[model samples]
Target: MIRHLTNGISIVFISWIVGMIINAFLIKTKRYQEKLTNLNFIKSKKINKLIGIGLIKWTVKNTFFKFFNPKLRMNNKVEPNDLNILRNEMTLAEINHLIAFIAVAIFALSMVFKGKYLPAFIMMMLNTLMNLYPSLLQQENKRRIDKLKKVFTRNHVSVTATESLNIS
Candidate 1:
């Protein structure tokens, strides 16, 4: 059972790495350039307006939570009211991880059928790492935001007073 699981895991890891490399290459080459073109020539301002409204609602919700919800507040961190936004940002990372997992599973199955163990075990670890990477990124971003907020807060008082006093 352990050997089969390991085999599945390794194949998934390799396939996932390949997928990410391909995605990076495509991004650099502007292979999906059409997406940019479509966004730029948006004919319906209605969609834009709807998006604006949605943003406003999200802002209001976030503000309410950040100011009023103690449990949601992190020390010096902006509390995101819309968890969906975080999830959306994570979607790409999740997809990459999923791809890796699938590849590993396939590889493990192959090993089981072929009576191999070492490669399968290796892939399991790799796939697990790949899938967990996105969660790491989310934590990193949170830390960065906290640091930025501290910097801005320190400067804000001086900046506001300067503006109010009409300092040239």
Candidate 2:
């Protein structure tokens, strides 16, 4: 059981590395970004809450994972350009975790076919926790960023118009 658990953990990590490599290659493509932008699996914030995404978000922020990727962190004051950069980063992260989840899931399914149910179960559980939830969390964050961007754009445009009128 220990061996199975260890192997499962190792597979999750390996899958994560593979995902990063794959995402790095794909990130430069416009089609990939467009597809990711249109991808909305969980549309409702309530559904996100129901799935315990808040817990995952809290864990990532509070744990060593926060230190692992500092780029994802946002400051108190964020401009539209900053939000655009953050949205791109979130897309990259979301795709990475999604790839990792699919890779680990495939391995787990293979283990099931081979009659190694315990290891498969362990692998799938870890994959869901490490990869799936994180991807979902990123999606949620991207949605928030999109909303914020709209607000920022609107406010900026209005402010600019007001400034122009005052100058005139």
Candidate 3:
């Protein structure tokens, strides 16, 4: 019975790791890139270029989240439903990654307890990579936002000057 339980857990863990890796590949390749870019082509002036930039930035962040969600175990500050949608859409992948992560963690802890250094070192490296992927997306968003703010300010100034001249 104990052997069966360990085997089952191992299988679950392997499946999760495989699924997360697949999703990560898909997102990083930017398959949905053009779909969201089309949103910027709207005719309304109110929509503006800034909105498009914002949308693209958001899409990148969301794609990053969807890809490696299991390893990261992240949450959205603004919407709970978004997290649910992400998990649901990538169900098998998310499940496999999470289970694999838990299994690896347990294995690493066991090794550490026994003073087995090499396995623990490898597991820690993998864990660090999983954790860092999400932060890269977040930092990219901040950089994009700073660039957008400058553009927005420039556009605001030009529009204001044009309008003031017309009024005179």
TM-score of 3: 0.29
Q: Model 3: residues >4 Å from true position, as ranges? A: 1-87, 128-168
Off by over 4 Å in 1: 1-14, 17-85, 132-168
Per-residue alpha-carbon lDDT of model 1 for 39-157, expressed as tens digits? 22223436534534334324434555234223322332223332233333333343444445565567666876787666665655555554443323333333333444454567653
The prediction achieving the highest lDDT against the true structure is 2
Candidate with the larger TM-score of 2 and 3: 2
Cα lDDT computed for each candidate against the true fold: 0.43, 0.80, 0.41
What global local distance difference test value does model 1 have?
A: 0.43
Candidate 2 per-residue lDDT over residues 4-110, each given as its tens digit: 88898899889989999998888788889678655679999899899898889888977887876678877655667877887778788889889999989998899
Better candidate number, 1 or 3, judged by lDDT: 1
Question: Distance (Å) between predicted and true CA of 15, model 2?
Answer: 1.2
Backbone clashes in candidate 3 total: 2
Span of ten consecutive residues with least summed lDDT in model 2: 159-168
